[model samples]
Target chain A: MAFRYPDGRKFEPKRNEMTKKSVNKDARFSNRGMTLEEDINETNEYYLAHQVAVIHKKPTPLQIVNVHYPSRSAAVVTEAYFQKPSTTDYNGVYKGRHIDFEAKETKNKLSFPFKNFHDHQVEHMKRVLDQGGIAFAILRFSYTDEVFLLEATHLIRFYEERDHTRKSMKKKDIEHFGYLIPLGFHPRIDYLKIVDKLITGS
Target chain B: MAFRYPDGRKFEPKRNEMTKKSVNKDARFSNRGMTLEEDINETNEYYLAHQVAVIHKKPTPLQIVNVHYPSRSAAVVTEAYFQKPSTTDYNGVYKGRHIDFEAKETKNKLSFPFKNFHDHQVEHMKRVLDQGGIAFAILRFSYTDEVFLLEATHLIRFYEERDHTRKSMKKKDIEHFGYLIPLGFHPRIDYLKIVDKLITGS
Candidate 1:
């Protein structure tokens, strides 16, 4: 079943919320079971609390068609359609630097699928880069428990080369081109550390 | 009846074909008699194409509960609920500065109602201003066909004073403190001009 909102629109607020609920206690107990999205959200909260940065995930857009007003104070969405997002998953500012990125998780144990990313996303990243903004992606190999912060420039290169080659990028490829992000407790995923490295290296 | 995605998932692919439907006889008719949301979307496209800025309305979050899969390829949403937004409606980058604003429309001919603005949104704008980002609200008086870009600082002042003084800001105060942005043909609402003025004034 699809989700409906207070205004009668169809869009799932959070795809992993129910699963998160189920494993919430277990996660709290074992310190193991946090989804990529949840961890990123938590990390963002931590960043905000520490006055470090202000990053946010763009919500999934929905085109509401039908609305049910049960009373003067209540408006429930009865019918709505989902809309495709044009930009990246997350964006914000960090110490005066504009930051933008998309997060993706793969179950692949050996290599990440190039097909996981859309062409428009690559184009968007390119535009962000051209306009002098930091653009990158956080890739998580779910099965292997590995996380890598791949710069948008490297992703763009792989994207450009895809027309010539139809194969997925090997683990070694990302390991060489991307910075390995060590997960911590406060900001569970410390992507800014890698960002600091990138800015300093440049 | 509520609309559902093909696969009964919460997400529906964007209707790319609908964009083709927008192109009409007159270049000014690009909005194509769509809803206010569609019109704003078209305006955002124009803004992006002209390299003016990258403003986008954040999507409404929905918490879907049940979905019915009528067929292998078709999904029908059965139940869901709306979630309160934590941030402003629109945010983007412009000329190396981060710009964040909310757009609101009112039918009242006298004054833009204070109820149109939310407490959290005002708080968000205050933080944005403190962080050195340009924050404001675009108020469209639909009855008079007039639009005004009011700075967040002005809004914060009015809002803070509301506890001891008047409940709402008069139209005259808005006219004095806000920049009147005449509705245009190409961008429909040329806010960049006001932004330029704000930057220059600072």
Candidate 2:
């Protein structure tokens, strides 16, 4: 005996049951526990649709091992592993300026850990700044729900100073050097307005 | 009895034999039949390593359906499908300017088909241009081994005129409107020289 819909379509009970449970769990998490990444992605989508800026978060790189190619359909990746990203998470054009940045979320109320960024990523940001592009990091305090856009110069300075003092940057230092991004209804995290001020020096 | 290497490692005969055959076949093709995409990727790698410029081809977007998470190792993608890219293949910062472009290779000797580009990609390129960022296309003739850097403005004009004329842009038209990129050893496709000309009008 198998389960069937009202329209008489056959349904696999086990798979559907598992899927329903997963969906409910995801809904619960998304409502009150949406990640910083998810919020930034939604903001980027709004920016694109409204023709505000052309920024995008690059897709996570994967090293695929085996792919199953079925007839008359798309190939299915059977085995794959996530590769460490070689560059920053986000980059694009904003007002003809090359904008590049990484987004990091910290649960600590007092400080953000320096270990959140890799050595290569810090070096990459240095190169972007050297080439005259605008580079920064969006640091999100998960507990406070506060987001700040910290310029690459300030980030690099703090990164280099990690060997001498604290292993993390204090919230007060971030407040001193970074611009706070206001959360809005449509765009969510409006970081571009901060960029505009940085460019104009106003 | 199982086959074993001199170093006491067991060798899987069937898998190794198949892998060796495939490697040989790929080597044969890569010698004289590598793709335009490969060349551009090699050039980008060279740019990054030498600290000349930072450019990267975005990874192919995939829609993951199922994942198997093992306790000891990284999560493996059990099922996934390729998704149509919403943006161009390549984009980066070059000399303080946002650079965005698509590379297309055609075997057709007479004309490059407009069908190589999707409507969304063309629209995206137009947006890049409107924001004063540098946008262009790298058109490569596979048979002739010729590559040209055509600016986005010219490409948009020809794309709009496609309904009134032939479905493809003629080689003569490409020659007239685009700058030919001379192939070199170190940097491979030296398209940046043409970008310099575009910027300074030299």
Candidate 3:
């Protein structure tokens, strides 16, 4: 049995790869060329090894339709599909506190679009908070290489406000309310620092 | 793209069917009359819906080697294999407490072979206990329709004593130390009662 995608596996080609990167008005904020998912995963690895926290990205659920048995020792997956919208992107325990969060990156320099947040995820975060869990999001302005930890309570407020207007969250709003985390090398994103501040106000 | 397997699809013969019932010494236990994996899954669902706990069975990690895109809506998994032994069978949160456990069912009426458990799982449970998390096992004596929630500390003691003339824990020994949870319709197995006892001894 194997735990990872078998070697030589290939992903489906990007559907809109032909479209060029959007040109933004702010010339100073060139989009950083790092995948948010990869960075967060690496940081989680560092956290686990250091015995700090144990956060993990939930596997993208797949519905397996058909499998074939070639030999007694192994079987091959014949078909599968993504399951559905997930409750949250990441979840685990941190110092006995239940930790849950989602990550989103936006290319827009001036605003973080509300569309990047999903309704169900918002609802799930609300429930987590109600259950006394620490819930939040890591919003990254890809254009500026900036990452901010926004409390779910604040995000819920923005989510509720979406009904009256279609406006995205202005960059200044997050700057004022969220904890701006400086990017680092070892734990790439030192999110626990923000978590400590959120829980302890330190 | 569909996230679920296509409707009305099935796997090969050998991979589909597993023994579902055990009978020994006038005691009979149903495998939930389903797969071991499915039972744990349903139990977790029962646990979550009742707000009694939040436990999840981690997806079995697999290595995918090939996928056939028969259509845009469906991706057929062509080759995959199970990975290495897992650390634990189930994990999640319960009343702000980190919960970790493994579920195992044995057919033998006289004794459950120690080999049913992996070394990694034992180690994982120990680690969780060291970190102040609750760790245990849902051991189903399939021959007797009995399930016990045995604390990891007790199990660890038994595990280490294996070389010192204790081959496997006797059924009576487990009954004396573990909490036998009568399966119910909702929350399936109410292990939390045992947890309450563990926490307060009341």
**Higher-lDDT candidate among 1 and 2?**
2
Candidate 2 per-residue lDDT over residues A181-200, each given as its tens digit: 99876677889889999999
lDDT of 3 at B201: 57
Computed on C-alpha atoms, the DockQ of candidate 3 is 0.21
Ranking by lDDT: 2, 1, 3
Number of the top candidate by TM-score?
A: 2
Stronger candidate by lDDT (2 vs 3): 2
Candidate 1, residues A1-202, lDDT tens digits: the string is 3444444433334545332343446565443676688888888888877877778898765555544545444345565555545788898777656788998878888788876676777888877786667889899998877899999998889878875456567778899999889988877898998988887887
Specify the poorest-scoring 10-residue window by lDDT in model 1 chain B: B9-18
lDDT of each: 0.71, 0.76, 0.68
**DockQ numbers for every candidate?**
0.19, 0.27, 0.21
- Candidate 3 lDDT at B198 equals 80
Q: Provide candidate 2's TM-score on chain A.
A: 0.83
> After superposition on all CA atoms, what RMSD does each candidate show versus the true structure?
6.5, 10.9, 8.9
Standalone chain B TM-score for every prediction: 0.77, 0.83, 0.77
Report how large a share of the reference interface contacts model 1 reproduces.
0.14
